[model samples]
Target: MSQRSIKITMSAVLLAAATLASTAPAGAAHGGEPLTDVRVATHFDLAAGQMPENITLLPDGTAAVTFAAGRQVALVSPGGGTRILATLPAPADGGVHTPVLGFPLTTGIARTPDGTVYVLYATGTADLTGLWRLRPGQDPQRIAALPADGLPNGLALDAHGRTLYITDSVLGTVWTVPTTGGTPTAWSTASELAPTGFLGANGAKVRGGALWVTNLDRGTLLRIPIRSGNRAGAPQVKASGMAGIDDFAFTGRGNEVLAALNAPNTVVRIRPDGTSTTVLDAADGLQNPTSVALRGKDVYVLSAAYTTAADPNLLRAHLRGHR
Candidate 1:
């Protein structure tokens, strides 16, 4: 769905600024405990339509990000350099047929060690909505065809990188496709993945033989085990009460995670027990934070400024007490 849609849905539950101030303690005023050194690493040109939607980090500290509204993928370096990689061609009708959001958008992204980048595009048209693969120097190619009626939102590669799993927010399904590209399989259609009104199954990741996903409208984190013979076990809701959560990254500390709460303009650290704490908020320059990534001790956050419509940028923070 659109940012305006999210803002309207989240307005009632937005954490008040006064509540945040009252919760501040000695050393964690701006950023809550276990998060520090928060700062903007790069300020994207919002006027140029450079709002980042999802991110994947390379080994060299560079980030491959999908510009949701721009229908483009670009790389951002640690030192704040930016480079446009490729722009997906617009549909003949200019995405007028696009689903819920009413426009074509690039969503989740995942990169392999060999530099093969796979990203998702949703134009609500059969000819252009699906998963696209981009080799080092080749133009982006549609590898798999997804349903035009569904909103393909999140993308992830499995443990061996042999399979790609996708989340369709509108359809409330999880689709699996081979890395080489082919027809997608509706791997799971759990009711938990259904959207309340806006969107569902927003962000996804595969780890520990299970696929982890977030439902934006339901405000819940779900895990579906990858059982033997490539079957999907029953889904389990791991966490809830986080409205507007867009995307998340595992903290490498067991099941701990850092998740971006989009309309709330906050990033939170969720513990294994399902409890969450506000790690970074608007005070740290978060403007509709879309995704979170972790590279060693650094925490990378992409703010699309979708609702705020100002300061679309990337912020980095230090993860304290991270062993």
Candidate 2:
């Protein structure tokens, strides 16, 4: 990957890592030619009624899907599909109570390099519900929480996994927290960035010298230079052509951002210069796809419904209402 592409995708450092690690050069991850079609590499079918809010791949390559309806996080395997794991109850530690700012309406998820899983839920009692660290044989512990109305939308980690990036939709800001012990501190405030304000801070990634964030209400993607933990100066929008944009991933060599649009059940591949092409029209294997998770060349999409061919209503609806 080229320096600019790496900087664009993960942050410039990741670009350096890629170049030092490989000799593919600039035009590698970027499509060598104009791209066409939304490729369906694999489809792992799950239960029809179970909706997945967020997804993360385990160390063993197993995929974990967070459920919106139950106390169980579904452990999905190739053949087993989904095995319910009881949501470990929060334990009391000393007199130091980890505030349950938002529990149970779990949305954000991240993992350390060692496979420790951190899941955030809306704590029913306060602004934050629960922050749980799930380690094998270790009872889940509530480490941190966010405000009740403060929705934690995106989660990302550094190369070493010590630092975590989180987005606060209600506050329209981003935070950097230590994976070990610490109250999440402000990393960047939206007001300092030009365009002045953010609609809703949704998804985030600290990869390759840039910090990539998703602004849901604004239907845009943003980038900021990474220096230590500070976002410092203003951030720039990488792309702004989707409606109801929620989450995005750096896939296909880091030049493309695949965004899952909520309304028309669509996913679009956007370029670095803000141009976009609808890879999956609402009629193509999508139905209110809330999130898109990438694992290598495959993509796991969470949707409220399914999209099908022989459908004018689905595709036309997106043409009129979305990007």
Clashing pairs in 1: none
What's the CA error at residue 182 for candidate 1, in Å? 0.3
For model 1, the superposed segments whose C-alpha errors exceed 4 Å read 1-32
Compute the lDDT for candidate 1: 0.85
lDDT of each: 0.85, 0.54
Q: By summed lDDT, which 10 consecutive residues of candidate 2 come out lowest?
A: 309-318
Report the C-alpha lDDT of model 1 over 98-188, residue by residue, as the tens digit: 7666667899899988999999999988999999999988999999999999999899899888999999999999999999999999999
Against the true structure, what is each candidate's TM-score? 0.91, 0.70
lDDT of 1 at 129: 95
List, residue by residue over 1-323, the lDDT tens digit for candidate 2: 12222113222212232232233112223233232344332243333224455677775656676654233456767343567654644323311122222123456677776768877664344433545577766766767665544556677777777877777765676777778846777778765221213236677777667778876556678886787535544688787645456676666555577777654355666776777665664445565565666665455566533222111111111112111
Candidate maximizing lDDT: 1
